[model samples]
Target chain A: MSVAQATRPPKAPAGLTHAELNALRADFPMMSAQTNGRPLVYLDSAVTAQKPQVMIDAATRFYEREYASVHRGVYSLSQHATDLFEQARAKVADALGAGKDETIFVRGTTEAINLVAQSYGRSVLKAGDEILLTQMEHHSNIVPWQLVAEQTGARVIAAPITDDGEIDLDSFERLLTGRTRIVAFTHVSNVLGTVNPVRQMTRMAHRRGAVVLVDGAQAIQHLNVDVKELECDFYAVSAHKHFGPAGIGALYARRSILDAMPPYHGGGAMIRSVDFGGSTYLDGPARFEAGTPHIAGAIGWAASIDYLETLDRQRIAAHEADLLGYARDRLSEVENLRVLGNPSERVGAVSFFMSNAHPHDVGTVLDQRGIAVRAGHHCCQPLMKRFGLPATVRASVALYNMRDEIDALIDGLHEVNEVFG
Target chain B: MSDLRELYQEVILDHNRRPRNFGELEPPCSEADGHNPLCGDQIRVYVRIVDGKIEKVMFQGSGCAISKASASMMTDALTGKSVQDAAKLFEGFQAMVTSDMDATVGDEMGKLAVFAGVREFPARIKCASLAWHTLQAALKGAHEMVSTE
Candidate 1:
């Protein structure tokens, strides 16, 4: 056997074993933290994951020892810093099965989507053209396109979602027409935890001659993402959502499409030559990347990717699926609780409403018991409106989460019922 | 649990369960809408003024217990009070929720002093004060919607 395989633990029949999961949990320092004199049960990973010690250390080590501006000075320290930064880019590209030249570092998914909506959407979209989006899209995905559409006099159209919260394939296909210039949607709904069929949707959009962008903010943590397999024109991911540092993310765009797109922001690093008369911009990813990048954040993100690579992704997916099912079942047992969106395949999160209390009230009670959950529109007000709910209480899971944490959430929810009953 | 009980006291829960003055006022009255965009809490305050006094005050909307109960109790307190007195109560309620936890509430607050617990939970202060802000807008003849962003 290969040395890597030989050293790896024997595969569990279904997900990680109890001891294995506990060992993994120890990697995250926040797992041991206490809130309100009770052990913290972090159930809001979908909002932003608690960082692993490795990622924290990686960023600290870089800032403390190897801090230098990349691609500028001729000194060895600057060269070393450049090498480390480029190595991080390579790791991000490899993680998505994308070309190194096609991956551009951004300030999380919002900036990435805004980059595309401005650079590509503005360049191609015309008056009377349509940019088709799904009802399940986060505000990040929807608002950028709307801004671009308004600028170009192009119309923004939303594809309907089904009662179960899945993007209705039939409705989506029908929305795509010859006038459609772009299609943007999320790989997974942050609130509902519904995983969309990106490959199928990409194929449909391609048939209509439309470029596709997939929001990977909620997907990268749970799924083994391969941009080549999904065949999407562009994909965006936030490092913070996947246990890395905040304010840093990566965008994977197809080589030809990225090559044709103009520079998003104008600054020093993106130029080939500069003069007062006229300046020339470089081709590929650097064209879109403008100011001094987040070097330490990239390093920390690379460490997070390395940490994830050490774990078997399939087993993690299975473990999260089990937790989602358990959460849904337990939430249903509550007398007045109503779990939203019975999507066929869900990951990471489960959103619900209790008839007896508003989500905010339930969230407050849960907070007192040291459980962290999200209680709001989740930045998808349109999606909340689709279900006719003001807000929902979202309990999200990460790899370190255990069944006991879920049980604690259940008990906290019971307390909410008692207080508001 | 004690902290929670402090925040969601029995009076607050009762007011939330069956809010007083819980409907829109008829025409010839001023009304203003309040919205907390973060949590989707919305309250619309309606009032009928007679000789610069609030002859009738009512509200209609959907929100959490804190917001709903605060609105319910606000209408009850504002009835038969002059616009100036209503503004003073708004100021006192806002101070009670925003002040330090141990600060003494003014006697003018009366039953509204229950919201002193909100000082400990800074995030809920906006929820407790959303209706008061709307009520102030209605009293000022500003029909524009107010948002606690």
Candidate 2:
């Protein structure tokens, strides 16, 4: 079949029946939302996934029925709340094939990376040490390392990506020297959707005695990520990137590595004993988690994981891959529009720019049509600089997204072209 | 071709396609950079004022069609006006773009009334005003970058 004919109306592979996917879509109330006079076509899941009704209900139930602070009170409500909160940590660990003690609940991937850099990085890295990173890392992954490197007198070196945006494996391996103390990179690029071979890269880094931290913020939502299988020393994921509440995420680190790191934040709950001389700290996970955590957010995150457990992940991934291919094919047909990367394996996100229209203009026009997209640097200014672009318009897919939404996005781009022309 | 068309008027598109006074001025120019971090719109405004009148105005940066067009139209409107007059016009243009739809757009604003449609898009007001803010900074002889947060 001709390219246009094949891509114009893309079809999902026969995974879950149409009714099943529709029922799943029905779980998100925002699916029926509108802007101006058009139905909402949410193509910005990379920014934040729309929470499902289960997540809302879970958080509401915690507040309405099981409302209390965790880990401190002798009261029954507090005890119950504590159990559920800790259970949430277990759910995050289970999702990543990690032990409960290996996971520390934090506030999103940004905070998670900061915790690692400040605690683990400061403890291990010394003067003249090197922290190697990939070119496609989000600002969250890059900035934290830079801060830690500055403090420890270490330097951050970036391994380059190929022209099509895949991690240059040879360059990455070469960059892993004796002085390389840490190797941090994104599991999947937020802007390009390029899925790095985390297993292979982690092994390579480990061979050179460098600790690897995979920023799995963009990976866990769309792909089945197992930190154990990847064999990375640390992995960070945000619950909000999936169908969970905001302000909560998880960091998975090896038990040995966590045991060696110091406490990142000094506050209540992270200490075991207080004395005038000094304070004794708690164990690994507890050592990192200070202050009262987001209790409701954790419960809601567990609920999201529970909801994900009901779906066939392989089937969902297949459907997402099909959507990505179809989107690339269809988007190519738009005149003067350039889809940013042609990675061998891309996931949910696609960044593109129309030659005649700036990303902000395109984003504004799309918003008017009730099609939401992320525009600008997407918290990846370094990557934008690598591509010689100031910004791009990004449309990211989720499990609930349908081919109709892609059609709507294509229609919105046509409108943008008309307006700009 | 409704509210959107109003926002992206032919005049605005024309200015975007061929922005006027879009280059750097040599030394002896008062210049300031403006940034709207939300959309990554960056603009540098350069002015050569003589006897308090804007003898020449130019802008060099990359941004959206609205931002580039707004910068282009702003330079054209303020080139021959005094610094105080330019500030007044900037205030009027800002009010016209951000205020109520029925807010007055006096003939003093001239071609800048096209940005009145920005009132409908609250997020784009910064895009339409970056160059103007930079212009204000230039007039004040401020060296720090101006940001429309």
Candidate 3:
């Protein structure tokens, strides 16, 4: 089979059957594990995904046999390691429809955004300039801009979201005034599961002469992200959220934008030559990746991408959509339970509140039943404040998740009501 | 189920449902806000001290059952008690909740013994202790909010 044929599964039906899903779940060892003596019903994939055995093996193999410092040693082992690392980079870049030289690996999404804020943001923003963001952004997207705004005297402004948790496009356009130098927002909200119209937002920001940065942390895992198609100047994502190892992610920026920006950090690998005077820096992604990178994490992340490529992403999306619909339908039946948002389109996650119980209390009850869900602000305190909620219970799904798990979650919710009733 | 029942005993659920001394105290009272950044649980504790004794203690905030009940029960126990006794009780309460599951609850804890199950849920120790920590800050006349980061 050709490499493309090997990577891409043949087109199948729109969604996977129950048996096929169960077979896929076997690839993730955690699916069989128990929590608190009961079978674990993991519904917290939005926070971080459970890794498949292939990803784990890839990382373990790299550490155990192929470990070496890349772009440093002349030996065959180092060359082989360099080949694997670069191949991983190429895979990640290809997944996003970006060039290999345009992808720079960092610690995670938070660091990726910070890289742009400190490097690209500081270079352009000035006093009285504004940074436009939506109210549904995670703290990772919001705080980085605020930090840059504080340093550069640029004011940070937030566009409002509708009662249904979708961004108000009219307000977003209105906020993109001449003073707006950069528009940073999330492609998919981590809290509300609202998928923003990235292409539309990018066109609006561009028409206003503002550069756009998208937090793709939540989108990359659930959606088929094409940074080029989105026309976002910069895109950031985390590997851990993609069923890969933690502590590694990528920032996709066009070559021209990257070339114009100064290096985020100065260190050994990033420098071409050094002296007591100023040192010259390497060009492309190397300019930002200081020191040795997370070699094992990169390989593991590539393996995860490969694992995802083997399955039909469209089918996975359909399955998740079905799960979301089922969850919402069952949640509405619970007495006094309120689903937080009603966006026209949502994916992977659903958040809710029970009038009789605090989210934390509800989380505890669910835990006792071996159901795992996130109960907190979900790093979107501003969004929570807009809804007048201190916190909410968030249950997110992944491709490996099944409809029965949603049933288990609904049962857990009923238990929460009974316990706290 | 047993563990959940233990953590959310009838007394705790009742206290959470209708917290005692649930409103802010008027003037001559010192107040401190306690925030649990982890879960966004916020609590404000107020105390009016006169003649080295707590003349009145009240609290107002929003949090989980563990935290609200803790605050409610704390106010009930500290009312009319000497400031020194209140401090001692705070230390004991902290110890009881943080101790191992097998540790014995001290006789001095009295009704506060209901919280012994907190030790089993380490993630919840902060939830049960937020109000107490805020009370400590209020007693110390701290102007800044206390955070269980």
Candidate 4:
């Protein structure tokens, strides 16, 4: 077969049948709950994953009896809280295969990117420099660079994604030059669910002597992410995206690079000494995190990670693969229902649109049925424009999702087509 | 709600496909544009008022189902309404999205009643109220409704 004829859609794996998948729905306690008396089919995880009971209880337990302000005080409770807070950070560092000196906790991925942007982007970058990115990045990845560009006189340039939703390696190579300071892009596209080759991208950036920042907001939940293997200079992920709480995130920057960069914010916990002449700053992550940290949120996030660790990573990945493959196959039954991405093994997500039906209308009807799927641009407005679509409806899957849920989604698409046809 | 599916209802599919009054008025009699940069919703409302009465009202924009359908329903309901009466009606619709509406406000804003369900969705209240807010701005002689953030 020729190259044109060689590429075809992959067949669904036979690991989990719809019946078996339906039976396994009890794994998630929330799946048993109802919304307006309808079964809750949550498929908007790219926005933020729903928390498991373990993470919930971690926060609840802390608030109930063990609550105390961390990192400041002589009380025994304060010391315990501080240890838990630091222990969570140490766990986060271990999660990313990084040292404690390399990880800094902020509000979320947006703040993490902003921290690096305001610190390294402003201080080190200069005019004529370019921060390279792919066209398929979320606005969170794009906007932070734009801010730094506006401040430092450096420019923001985009690498193109092929029509099939994978990044164009030729285009990426063309975009990079001596002035390329940082290569920032999403590890996975929120809409298309295309998992980019981070290792290869980092290697390409390294060849050009530029650092890379992978927006792993989607990856950590689906894939086994290791920063050492990826060799990215700065990686960002929102805790909420990985079954954790909102309002807290982690940024992994190489210690050598962070050592040269100054602190972005100034406040309590970040100071070493304060004199009339000048003030000295704390080192490493403490210097970057310059406020009263989210102690409860950190503890809760660690608990979420703990919950995921109880399950087999390989099993979760396989189950998601089965659901995604089955969903893709089932949706193809519709006349004009076209699945967006063409990944060999998709990261358990599907994005598409019907013949004449707008995604917003589809989303509303889905909401009425108590099926929560994200609709519209998925925060990649430029990608939507490139695809010549106003928006798309996306149903992203997690470990808790099953094939029957995917069937519900496919059947819903059929109803949408019948109504609109 | 009967079918556990993510399909748009017949009513929504019809509104989305046809999208009543889905064009800009050439040299619009009175026009105002509003955009929700948060969700990338852009809408422009046009009104041809004669003698303090809205002789004609129409809209053209790109947005979610609630915003577009609400705008279409807005024009259909407010076509020949007196500007003063329409203002009160707009307030009723606003109350539906922003607060609770009494029977008086409810009956007065007929057909627009379809969007009463929007109140349950706090994040989507803005989607249902975008056109009404623009109408309010247009009546006040404002030119545009950009991000108020």
Candidate 5:
């Protein structure tokens, strides 16, 4: 065996058994489903992870039993709803290693980033200022900064990634000059699965007097995120990427910073006082959250966190690492197929190209066999261009994915090769 | 499986491998670029219109098999046809691809019928029609890029 293979962790460790981990699949109803008369093998968790039954049940129960507006109504039901809503916020904050007051609820990572860009970015950035970002950021991370920069007469600069799909730290530090106001980068690349050195990068930016924002949409599900440990000024995440409900995510900001930033939207829940002349906004998270939020979605997301906490996170991470290693070895054996990057530290996703077929065609062939993978630029068109590829087929592994699924994906690629030949 | 096979038939694959009129036309009378941001599929449709007829129609770009084949077949179907006839053919092609399986294929569709099975994959409809949309934009003298969104 290769040294890489020799060092691979065992399937089951001392505490959590492999059987126990496999049993967690039962919580997800879609695990046993069949698509197009074949057993479904989902490998598109990077797009969105499937929710557990507990999360689904929590959302349904909220709608069926505890349906009421929060923070306004005073009746018993309304009070209960308000309590649950706040509890959900607390749950998310706890999972992210943040304080409840520092957490602001938004639609998803996109909205969270937008809120920062529009409110904090507009407040701080001036003419000739720069917003530094990495090349591997999702469009959500890039476009919001572009819009804010355009409005503020600031320019958005990108830090280049290494050939192995990692941020060049020396280059990043050099770019963090006196004029860079904000630096936003992904904690884990959605396409290449490179787990960035967030803490080190944040320290580097802090030394240069630049505040950092970490896009943790892909990392929150796969890794334990502690904002205090990373020392990042802001962290954005999406619930759907973490086996939680869609339309709900949270932003983790330092309490002082969040308190100082202006409101992102204007509405009933976020105001301290309203008048004919003008209005004043509330403090903490309420300042950013403007409207009646996704109450059920927040509750469902908290329930997902609760479910995730039940598992040994270390074991889950190890299992995913093993799966990624196995997938990398297996896929590399395919003829004329090339995995996009070989980052020293990567998570459970792999993006690859086949010489004989376009990514869409490969995706279709895989889909026909009930194997779901994402194709196209995977919303990293700039990175795609950097890699000199129009598109790539991405197979992302979730906790529920197994070696057999990877085998199925490899078989499907063989079929793609034969058909496109 | 049959629907998948029908969507990517041998003829379609052949056109993808060797697309007709695949390069840029020098100093064309009119041209328009097309882009599908979702897949990064890009095509530039160049046309030479004489009188009220399409004297020449060609495209240059890189895309998936369906998109490349659609562009090639469209070049064959539109050349030597009147401008109004090309518009009608665009409508027919659009209807054929976006319509349900039960929708009848028009006899006038001819070679364009190869894309009728695109209805099975709704996401690919944009891929199959990107060049046609660019062609329409070119004929309209609208130099602005066309998008499938």
Candidate 6:
């Protein structure tokens, strides 16, 4: 561990245990599934986490029993719909340690990022302004700024990631200036799995008079994120990356900043009134959420929050830490296969390139044995270019993944070596 | 080894290790780059045609086991074959990848028979046909094309 990691807060919060994690997995029906007759060992949680039965049931029940357009109709059912929608918002806000007014619902992390880019970026950013981002960001975080920069003639600057996969805070400090509008990067890298020091980075950005936006798609489910504690001005997350249903995410902005930004998409729900002269937009969050939001998905997302509550999430984090450590130890034993970004504080993500065998062959071979792992660039093409590889095989874990699965993965790695031999 | 056998065959790994018919050809002929950015597979097929007959066919670039193997197989299959004949071969091989029946592709694909098994793995269709597609584009006389990204 580096000096920075040694001083950084421990990976997980206090007070979590094993009985808790097992119960958490029991809540998810997918945990009990079999793919090709073998238990479905899903290790692609960085892409999307498995949905729990409770969240699924919550979504289905909403459609089956309480189906109505919210905030529109004056009927009893519509009122019920509106109440459920707002309650879900409140639940998510509580989960993220944010206020309801600060959270704006969108489709997923991608849309959440586009929301910030179009609203805050387009409206506030002027020519010669700079948007600072880390090289470890997913394309979602990197591209939106590019789009805004292209449109506004603003320059997008990159903060370098050190060889160990952590962001070079010195490089970040150098990139900062009065003209740096936004510093948007991932809270935890999806490919590298390095948990960034969000609090420290946010404070740094704040001192430089810049708003920081964190792509929490990878971190929201894994960490106990307190946006208030981090003092992050804008935080983006996708529900699917957590244990919730797909197509639901939230962009949490400090109330003042969200109020300052313009509406992203022009639509019916977002407008207070429309006349020939111009349309008056609704206040703050409603201004950001233009179309009909993910109503059922939001309700299900709330159920996911409820399900996460059952397991002390801190314990789940610790259990994953142990599994991650065990996996790292086992995988490192494999000859000629070097794990990418073996950070002192890595989340449950392992990206590695075989010395002789290409990653596609490795992924295919793994798939043949009923073990599924993501192959290729993992959507970080720039990161691929940084590492000077076309792609890599990635295995990411979640709360439900067990020690035996790690054994299976180790066996699979050896299987790859044997095949190549 | 037998079950882990089909997908990562010795021939596939061999091509991945020492890709046949590799390296770029100078311009003045047709060329198309096939890229699968998802898997990070890249291939460039360069063609030399004389009187509508492909007198010389060579390919260059790096990719995964399936792609490199498929490229070597295609180059070996089409070296003496004409542009028209190569197009037909490309069509037949594409059916093997896109079509649901594995036997149809396996039986028809002569030297490209190794890729027939890739038909079973649908996600790898891009990998199997990356070289074949570049060949088709080259035959159609498209130039400086980059794909797969």
lDDT of 2 by residue, A214-293 (tens): 99899888877777778889999999997898899999999999998989999999999999999999997999888999
Off by over 4 Å in 6: A1-22, B1-4, B105-108, B144-149
Clashes of each: 0, 0, 0, 1, 0, 4
| Candidate with better lDDT, 2 vs 3 | 3
Ranking by DockQ: 3, 1, 2, 5, 6, 4
How far residue A381's Cα lies from its native spot in candidate 5, in Å, is 1.5
For residues B107-136, write the lDDT of model 3, one tens digit per residue.
Answer: 999999999999888889999999999999
Model 5, runs deviating above 4 Å:
A1-18
By how many angstroms RMSD does model 3 differ from the true structure? 3.4
Instruction: Using TM-score, rank the candidates from best to worst.
Output: 3, 1, 2, 5, 6, 4
Q: List the residue pairs that clash in candidate 6.
A: B35-B147, B35-B148, B36-B148, B37-B148
Worst 10 residues of 4 chain A by lDDT: A1-10
| Model 3 CA deviation exceeding 4 Å by range | A1-13
lDDT of 4 by residue, B30-84 (tens): 7888887656778898888889888887788888766777788788888888998
Candidate 6 residues A275-357, lDDT tens each? 99999999968887777888999999999899888775556767787878888888889888988876667886978888877
Q: Write the per-residue lDDT of candidate 4 for residues A1-421, one digit (tens) a residue.
A: 2111111123323355566555555545677777656798898887888888788889889889889988788999999999888888888888777888899999999999988888988997999999999989889999999999999899999998888898898889888899999999888788888878887888889899998888988887887777887788998988998888899999999999998889899888889998889999988899988878888999999998887777656656667877777778788887777777685435746799765566766776677667889887888898888787778889999878876778778777776666657
Which residue ranges in model 2 land beyond 4 Å of their true spot?
A: A1-13
Report the lDDT tens digits of candidate 5 across residue range A230-313.
789999999999889999999999998998898888888998799999999999999888889999999999899999989877
The 10 consecutive residues of candidate 1 chain A with the worst lDDT sum are A1-10
Q: Candidate 4: which stretches are off by over 4 Å? A: A1-28, B2-16, B50-55, B95-125, B146-149
List lDDT for all candidates, in order: 0.91, 0.89, 0.92, 0.79, 0.90, 0.82
| Stretch of 10 with least lDDT, candidate 3 chain A | A1-10
What's model 2's lDDT at B5?
88
DockQ of each: 0.92, 0.82, 0.94, 0.38, 0.78, 0.73
Real contacts recovered, all predictions? 0.93, 0.89, 0.96, 0.37, 0.70, 0.85
Per-chain TM-score, chain A, candidate 6: 0.95
Q: Candidates 1 and 4: which is better by lDDT?
A: 1
